[model samples]
Target chain A: MVLASGSMALATRTERTPSLIGSVWRSTVGKKAVMAVTGVIMLAYLVAHMLGNLKVFFGAGEFNHYGAWIRTIGEPFLHHKWFLWIARVVLGSAVVLHGVAAFQLSRRDLAARPAKYAHARRRASYATRTMRWGGVILALFIVWHILDLTTLTVNPNAEEGRPYENLVASFDRPPVTALYIVAMLALGLHIRHGFWSAAQTLGANSPRRDRLFKVLANALALLLTCGFIAVPVGVMTGVVS
Target chain B: MNLTLRIWRQRTADAAGAMTSYEVSGISEDMSFLEMLDHLNEELILAGDEPVAFDHDCREGICGACGMVINGQAHGPERTTTCQLHMRHFADGDTVDVEPWRAAAFPVVKDLVVDRSAFDRVIGSGGYVSVPTGSAPEAHATPVPKPVADLAFEHAECIGCGACVAACPNGSAMLFTSAKVVHLNALPQGAPERESRVLGMVGAMDAEGFGGCTNTGECATACPKGIPLQSIATMNREFLRASLRGGRGA
Candidate 1:
C-alpha cells in the first residue's frame, strides 16, 4: 500500500489538475460568491412573495386562487404541487447554503483575530455592525414563519389548505402582528446591507455606481419592509378584512 | 508631557502576550508617537529592563513598515501611520494602549512587531507586472487616459501596511489585495495578465486565512495611505470578469 501510494504521488507531482470548484469553495472569495448568488436567489423569492402577499387587498377569492395556483403550476406536465415543492426545495437549499457559509466565514473571522482590542473603536455603520445578530433574528423568524403559514402547526387559527384565511388569522392577533413587524424590520436591515454587499461581492460596484447601488439597496429594503408589513397593517386596519 | 502607556509585551512569536504598563515623563508634544516610544524604550534600557520592540523604518510614513494599534485604532487616533502621528494629538498624562497588528496572518513577533511577511507572500502570488527587462519605453507609448492614470495612482498609494487587516473586525485583507489588483489592472501594460493576476492574488489571500470582506469599509477608513474603498469594488469586478472567462476555474 505504501509503495503504491508513493508511486501515485510521484506520478502526479507537478502536473496534477487543479480542482477549480474545490479551490473556489475553499477560498473566502469563493464563499462570498456563493453567498452573493444565494442572496440574489432569496431576494427574487422575496419580491415574488411580496407581490403575492399584496393580492390580499384584492379579496379572499383572488388571494386564495393565487395560493392554489402556485401548487397547481405545471399540473398537466408534472405532478400536482410539484412546482411548489420544487421551489421549496430550491429555496431550502439556498437558505441552508447561505447559513452554513455565513457561519463558517464568521468563525474564520473570529479565529483570525483571537485577541480583542482593549479600546476598539467602531468604523462601520450600525447596520454593518449588527449584521450577525440581524442574521440570527432573520433565521429564527424564518422557522416561526414556516410553522405559522406553511405547516399551520403553531398558528392559532390555522385553516388547512387555506393560505388567505391563515394569513389573516395569524395577523389578526396583535402579538403575532407585532412579532411579524419586528421580523420585517430586521429583514429590512438585513436587506439594506445584504443588497449592497452582494453587489460588491459579485463585482457590480464602481465609484460611479456606488451611490446608485446604495440608493437602490435602501429603496429595496423600504419597499420590501413596507410591502410585507402592509399585510399585517391591512389586517389591523380592517382594510383586507 | 508625561504619559502612561499600556503596550503589548510578547517575548517571542510563540510566547503568550499581555498588556504591560509603563510610565514616561518629560515627553515633548513635538515628538512623534514613535519617538515617545523611543523615550520609553530608552528609559527601559537605562533601567536594565527589556525595551519594547516595535517595527518602524522611514519614519516618514511612506514605507508602510511601521504600524500599531494605538487606543484601539489601526495607526492611532489620526488616519496617519504610527510614525507620522505626532505627540500633540494626545494630552498630558493620557493613557495610551499600543499593540501590534493582531491578525492570524500577522502573528506578533515581539512587543509591537508582527510578522507581516504573509503580505509579501500574497504579493508574490500575482501582485506584480511581468515585463521583460529592456531599455525604457517612450513615456507616452501606453497612452493611459488621465482618469485611468489618476485612479491607478490612487490605488498605487497603498503602502502594503497590514493596518487594513488589523483595523478590520474580521481581519480581512481585501483592501490590500484590491489595491494591488486595481493598481496593476488599470494600466494598459497590465491588460495581458489581468485575469490571472486577480485570480492568483485572491487565491493566495484566502489561503493565508484572512477573513472575508463584509463591506464594513473599515479597511479604507483605517488605511494610512488613504487607499479608497472603491479599489475593493474594482478588484471584485476584475475577479468576476476573470472567473466568467474561465481564467481561474470559477
Candidate 2:
C-alpha cells in the first residue's frame, strides 16, 4: 500500500508543475504579461529580419548572398530546411498567442458595461487602432513572401515574374515591389506601438527613460518604414534594377 | 465658465448610444469636475430627465472610479483624474466633450459606469499574495532599499481606476496590471511567489479581455496615479524570465 501510494504521489507531482501556467493566467495581470513578453520576442525577430532584408538594395548577387547568409545563420542548430521550419514554428506560435490574447481582451472591454463611465477617457493614438488591421495585413504578406521568394513560387493570378538573381527578379515588377513596401509599412506601424509598449507591460517605466522610449519607438518605426519603403521604391523606380 | 457638453446618453445598454449636446451655463472654476457634473445632474433632475451616469467615488482622485473623456482626452486635460480635476483648468464658453471610457473590456454599465469586473477577475486570478494566517512578522524582518520601497509605493498608488485602459490606444490595461505586479512583487515578502505572481497576473490580464499594450504612452498620461508606462516593461521581463525558467523546469 505504501509503495502504491508513493507512485500515485509521484504522478501528482508531475501534474503540479504545469499548473504554474494556469496560476499565472489566473493572476491579476497575467494575461497582459503573456502578450507583452511574446510581443518583445516578435519585435526582436522583426528588427533582425528587416536588417537582413535590406540586402535587396545591394543588387541581385548581394541580395541573394544575404538570403543565403540568412539561411545559414542558424548554422549549428538549423540547416536550411530546419531553420525555415523552426522559424515557422516560433513565429507562428507568437502570432497565435498574440491574436488569442487580443481577441479575448477586446471581448472583455466590450462587456464591461453597466456602472461604467467613471473612467471614460480617450487618450490613445492612431497606431492603436491600426494595430488590429496591421496584423491582418502582415499575415497575408508573410505567406505571399514565402512563396514568392523562399519557394520560388509565383501567384497564378499575378505571375508577372520570377525571383531570379538572389530574389532581385522578385522586385523587378512595380506591383510586387509596391506590395513589399506596403507590407513593410504595415510592419512599421505595428512596431511603433510594440517597442515601448512591451517595456511598459513588463513594468519598467521611469520618467526619463519613458521619454527616451517614445522618441526611440518613433524613430525606429520611421526608420524601418521609410527604409523598407525606400528599398522597394528604389527597385520600382529603376534605381535597383 | 460656460461649457458646451457632449454627453453620451443611452436609456439602457440595450438602447443605442448617442452623443447629445447640452449648454451648461454658469461657471465656477473652483468646483471639482465631478461637482460640475453634479450640477448638471441637478439640472437634469429638475427637468425630470435622467441624470448622466458616470463613475466616481471618494471625489479625491485616488479611487480611479471617475473617468470621462473631456475634449477628446481621458480625464480631461489636467493630467489628473476627473474627480480631482477642477473647473479652473477650463476657460469660459469652452465646449467639453464628455463620454464614457471606451473599451471592450470596460462595457458601459449605465451611462458612465462601466463594468470593470474584468479587472477584478484579473485580480482574482492572482494579483495578490497567497498569505497563510500567521502571527505578524517583524516590520523590519527584511530591510528593503528606500528606492525599491518608493517604487512599490508609487505603483501601489494605482486605485484600479480604468483611466489607463480608457486612455490606451489598444484599450490595454497593461498599465494597471503591471502596476499591481510591480507594487507587490518589489518587496522581499513578495519574492517567493515572484515568478508565479507575475506569470499569473499577466495570464489573468489576457484572459480577462483587455487589449495588448501598443504603448503610445497615453495610458501613463491618463493614469490617475500617474503610473509610468515602464511598469509594463518590467512585468514583461519578469514574465519572460519566469516562462523560460519554467520551460527549463526551473
Best by lDDT: 1
DockQ, each predicted model? 0.56, 0.28
Error of 2 at A161 (Å): 14
- Which TM-score value belongs to model 2? 0.74
Q: Which candidate wins on TM-score?
A: 1
Lowest summed-lDDT stretch of 10 residues in model 2 chain A? A155-164
* Candidate 2 structure quality by residue, lDDT tens digits, B128-176: 8767789987888789999999999999898887878776656777888
Native contact fraction (fnat) of model 1:
0.67
CA error at residue B163 for candidate 2, angstroms: 1.2
Task: List where candidate 1 sits over 4 angstroms from the true fold.
Answer: A1-20, A72-80, B248-250
Whole-model Cα lDDT of every candidate shown, in order: 0.88, 0.73
lDDT string, candidate 1, A1-241, tens digits: 9999999999986433245676567778778889899989999999999998999999999998998889889989989999999999999999998999899999998888788887767568887887889989989999999999999999877887678889888988899999999999989998899999988888888878889989999999999999999999999999977
